[model samples]
Target: MTLQTTSAERVRTSFDKQGMLRAIGATLTDVRPGSVTIELRPGPSNRQQHGYVHAGAVSAIADTAAGYAAQTLMPEGRTVLTTEFKINLLAPAVGDRLVATGEVIKAGRTLTVAQSKVYALSGENQRLIALLSATLIAVDHVED
Candidate 1:
């Protein structure tokens, strides 16, 4: 298999181990070098009292997307974890589904900076609902 294909597969494998994402119904939609996208359907389980997608759900997907984006660039023995992140909720996430797209801004030997933009999609309209900036660190994989 090509390196790119292998890289995406690695991400998918790691993402499958995330219980929070599965609990909130998040799915990996696209995975590429330095970029990844996650999708979540806004339902009663994930919505706030206002009938909009909860901010925590939005943050979780964005954080995971950004963390996985950084992981895509690491070597086989390394894994990435979020060290810090800041999220801005620009608009209410009231839609059919939420899409978070993350891309690496700067990748260093130990730390990688990534950003995720979350959009709420309703019918034919898509609105930018949140923006997240995250820092991730590459560390040796721990035995499971």
Candidate 2:
């Protein structure tokens, strides 16, 4: 695993120490200069109608990915929060694990834009689960 410097690492570190990351069952898979990947497996509690992963769950994954991707480009000690996002459910969530890959398209002083694609690993083939576009804003928090 290559951990290229991430702008949000400082914030993620604090969040990790506070055990907030565990709430979503998310962990960093790959963190690099402009890209980030977050992995999650839909457990029993994440299922919705028809015994499949809920759309809400999928949306959360995308949001996480996009936020982290944006964070990778910010200055150290800065944290990012989602400002706006839009997601399109491309296909059914049919897989053992869901991988959300996000890349920063634009990074600015206050706002960042990211694009994400979610894939479900189904045996030998990967299926497209969702597509997301999001904007995040970097903020300074006094709480340490």
Candidate 3:
């Protein structure tokens, strides 16, 4: 589907309102018509038993990216919510930072499909840490 709004700033504004992202220190790095990238510098607080980033953290970012990617294509006054997602952890997430990139595969009137890839970045190297596929539903925002 064609983009309804390609305003990156608007997308960033919406992204900034997500309190979970703030709590996790995730930053919206890139926003495009059907894609978004989020970066996170995981601290000790986000690590698990083996000193690796927790699986939940990885999934959270991936999910957020995919949801945002679908939102980017939604018409004005509409918002998207994740209906379902499946994620696979491919590798241990140990690195200086993690980057999640989401791209929309299909955009429908009510439903959109997106895929996300999470990479663990250490120095100049990046390792694939997880992959996610999500289905999002678009709903009209009701303003009070």
Candidate 4:
């Protein structure tokens, strides 16, 4: 398979293991060498007052996308963990779905920095809802 295909598959497989991502109805939509996209439909449990997507759900998807973006660049047998993150909720997350696009800012042997921009999608329009900056660490994976 091509690198893009392999990367996408790897990210999707790892993303499937995330309970919170699944709970919030987020799915891995795209993956490349240094970028990934996650999409979510805000369900009843994902909303806060005013029937908007909660900040926690918004940040969770963004953070998870960032980690997967970094993971795409790591060597085999390696995975990523978020060390720190900062998210800015630019607008109310009120739409049919939310899409978080994550891109690697810098990739290093042990640490990586990435950013994710979350957008609320309605019909043919998408609005910026949140921005997330994250730092992640590469670690060896041990399968059980």
Candidate 5:
């Protein structure tokens, strides 16, 4: 795959679209350096016929969190995009809310590698439902 080089380091910036979506209606709740947490409430919109959250939603949240986690370590003028990802659904996502936490594993000159774990949060303990990993590419887009 064709990827951008990580030369001419740029200033770091927040992800506009991502922040907006998460701020408005997205289930994502918290984010920090090398980590993110997303929540998915059990509802008709997010659930399957079997009364469990859809796998796609699980993946989407995990990917977004992982991508943003990678973004947190990039320089200014540089942005991150997920180049590839994989998710392994482990258990039935049956709970009130699903929380996905992502952490960066490797940050390279051109790519950031991260992993996320999805948990079905109960009252006190959480159950592991999915595991996700992604390779994020850093791009320095110039504006005139």
Candidate 6:
């Protein structure tokens, strides 16, 4: 069954508030029902000892993407949080740009399961860098 999205703009707005994404220069490329994509241009600040993008950074983007993807399917006034995730680093993240795509596998009342894949993009080439499976929990947004 296909899940309907309530507000893509709201999701984008929430994503914009993430300081980590801003610090890493990540952009929200797409947002749809049960799916979202984030892209980042790797720079010196994000590189590891071998000049590759840090694994933590890669995982961060993947995790954020997954959480947001699940959030896209949630009702209005609901916020999503990452409960947990497991990731596998498959290849060295060496490229001009890194893209992470997340899609919801199952959407439940409280918990949603999502999967994300990170790819390193060079000119005309894309290499798989990592994969992640995550669980997200929905919570009511409280107005203070």
Which candidate leads in lDDT? 1
Q: What is the alpha-carbon lDDT for the whole of candidate 2? A: 0.78
Q: Which one is best on TM-score? A: 1
lDDT per residue for candidate 2 within 1-144, as digits (tens), equals 124443445535643653434654666677677777877787766678787778887888788778877877776557788999999999888688889999999999898999999999977889888999999998985466
Give the CA lDDT, 0 to 100, for residue 65 in model 4: 84
lDDT (10s digit) by residue, model 3, range 1-144? 234344566688788788877887789998888899999898876777888888888988999999888888777888888999999999998888999999999999999999999999999999999999999999887452
Clashes of 6: 0
**Per-residue lDDT of model 6, residues 1-144, tens digit only:** 233433788777788788988887788999988889999889876778998889988998899889989988887788888889999999998898999999999999999999999999999999999999999999998552
What global local distance difference test value does model 5 have? 0.73
Look at candidate 5 and give me any clashing residue pairs: 10-76, 11-75, 11-76, 11-77, 12-75, 12-76
Ranking by lDDT: 1, 4, 6, 3, 2, 5
Q: After superposition, how far is residue 25 of candidate 5 from its true place, in Å?
A: 5.0
Selected candidate, larger TM-score, 1 vs 3: 1
Candidate 3: segments with Cα more than 4 A from true spot? 1-6, 142-144
Score residue 98 of candidate 6 by CA lDDT.
Answer: 94
- What's model 1's lDDT at 60? 97
- Measured with C-alpha atoms, the lDDT of residue 9 in candidate 6 is 80
Candidate 4, residue 95: CA error in Å?
0.5
Q: What are the per-residue Cα lDDT tens digits for candidate 5 across 15-96? A: 3345533432355566666776667676766666887788877887788778877766776567778899999999998886
Q: lDDT of each structure? A: 0.92, 0.78, 0.87, 0.90, 0.73, 0.88
lDDT by residue for model 1 (1-144), tens? 488788899899888888989988999999999999999998877888998889999999999999989988988888988999999999988888899999999999899999999999999999999999999999998654
lDDT of 4 by residue, 10-41 (tens): 78877878888888788888888898999999
Candidate 1 wrong stretches, greater than 4 Å: none
Worst window of 10 by summed lDDT in candidate 4: 1-10
Flag the better candidate by lDDT, 1 or 2. 1
